[model samples]
Target chain A: DAMVIQNPRYQVTQFGKPVTLSCSQTLNHNVMYWYQQKSSQAPKLLFHYYDKDFNNEADTPDNFQSRRPNTSFCFLDIRSPGLGDAAMYLCATSTRGQGGGETQYFGPGTRLLVL
Target chain B: DQQVKQNSPSLSVQEGRISILNCDYTNSMFDYFLWYKKYPAEGPTFLISISSIKDKNEDGRFTVFLNKSAKHLSLHIVPSQPGDSAVYFCAAMTGGSQGNLIFGKGTKLSVKP
Candidate 1:
């Protein structure tokens, strides 16, 4: 079935170390998004890619970056892991609909633990 | 400030009963609403959605009601089952091409058999 998939469901990294999380989609959606969710907090949008264009959230920290090499793959790279950055990283995909209210489909998510 | 809010942190319901999850929004530009369910260690899955043009939308045992004037929406599950227990999140979208969704903190629902 067409679905989103994430690799390394659980990741452990040392402080200040760089880590990357990967996402892929079989749904062939045009948009891909990355979100960080802390315990008991809302999932906050970090960045997204519409086709090849990258859009980053205003409040997203500089440590977080994303790359979309192709339609099916997107990656989130943390330049320097921090204790506060330890959270579940989610990847979502959606088709660019005419009404702008497209439903997003999410991957299983990668839980990052910064030591 | 939070654009979408789910005031209830958690809710408990008995099986075969009704479960109502409420959501409120502070943004008037939000024209579309959605409900997502998340199990532990997994990403949220889309449950149902309602457009601002409509007051309600239903599917199977789940129903979503939108009160645009009040900037509030609710999800109701009829004959709730133990399998339905999960975290429910309310999300809103502005009417544009960006499709960036603003989501509320989730409400964990526990349905006891």
Candidate 2:
């Protein structure tokens, strides 16, 4: 019911292997975001898409990239997954309408375990 | 550097008591602050928020207080219940940014009934 969804609740990839995580939202919001969360740490912004306009965090590594092929789908691609990259990936969506900036709705994150 | 910081890693509260969660930030540029509650294996849900211009905001049993000078904010829950036990994260939004929130590590609250 109009919520964000992430595929493969859990993922496993070996060192140096490329991995892709997908996110989609039924909320039909114009803005979508990707965040990486390590255990017991804050969720860090990796990048975001505002209707296909990509905004990457200044501190985010180049190895991480995102593509929003369409309104409902956004993908996070890790060129070479490392053991250090193991963490939960979260997706969120929001719309900046009349009232201006609103709260973001997050999806149950995908826990990635790199082998 | 962590823009938002929840110094208290964990807290315990007695049932039906007031739960006060504190958050501090190093960035004076942050103009918006939010509180999110999360359960294990689940995503965080927005609880409440306060803008830098306002000193306080309230909803139902929850309230948020923002002190712009100190770069500190607080969330208060009255008559806390056991179900309130969960991880609470404090986040901040920089000026001119859309919905980008810099989050704190989180504080785990245990409400004992």
Question: What is the RMSD, in Å, between candidate 2 and the native fold over all Cα?
Answer: 1.4
**Which whole-number lDDT from 0 to 100 does residue B79 have in model 2?**
84
> Which ranges of candidate 2 are over 4 A from the true structure?
A97-100
Model 1 per-residue lDDT tens digits across residues A21-85: 99999999999999999999999889899999999888999999999999999999999998999
Per-residue error for B11 in candidate 2, Å, reads 0.4
Q: Estimate, for each residue in A1-115, the C-alpha lDDT of model 2 and write its tens digit.
A: 7899998799999999999999999999999999999999999988898887899989899999999999999999999998999999999998866533468889999999999
Provide fnat values for all models in the order shown.
0.75, 0.67
> Could you tally the backbone clashes for each prediction?
0, 0
Top candidate by DockQ: 1
Instruction: List, residue by residue over B1-98, the lDDT tens digit for candidate 1.
Output: 99999999999999999999999999999988999999999999999999899999999999999998899999999989999999999999887838
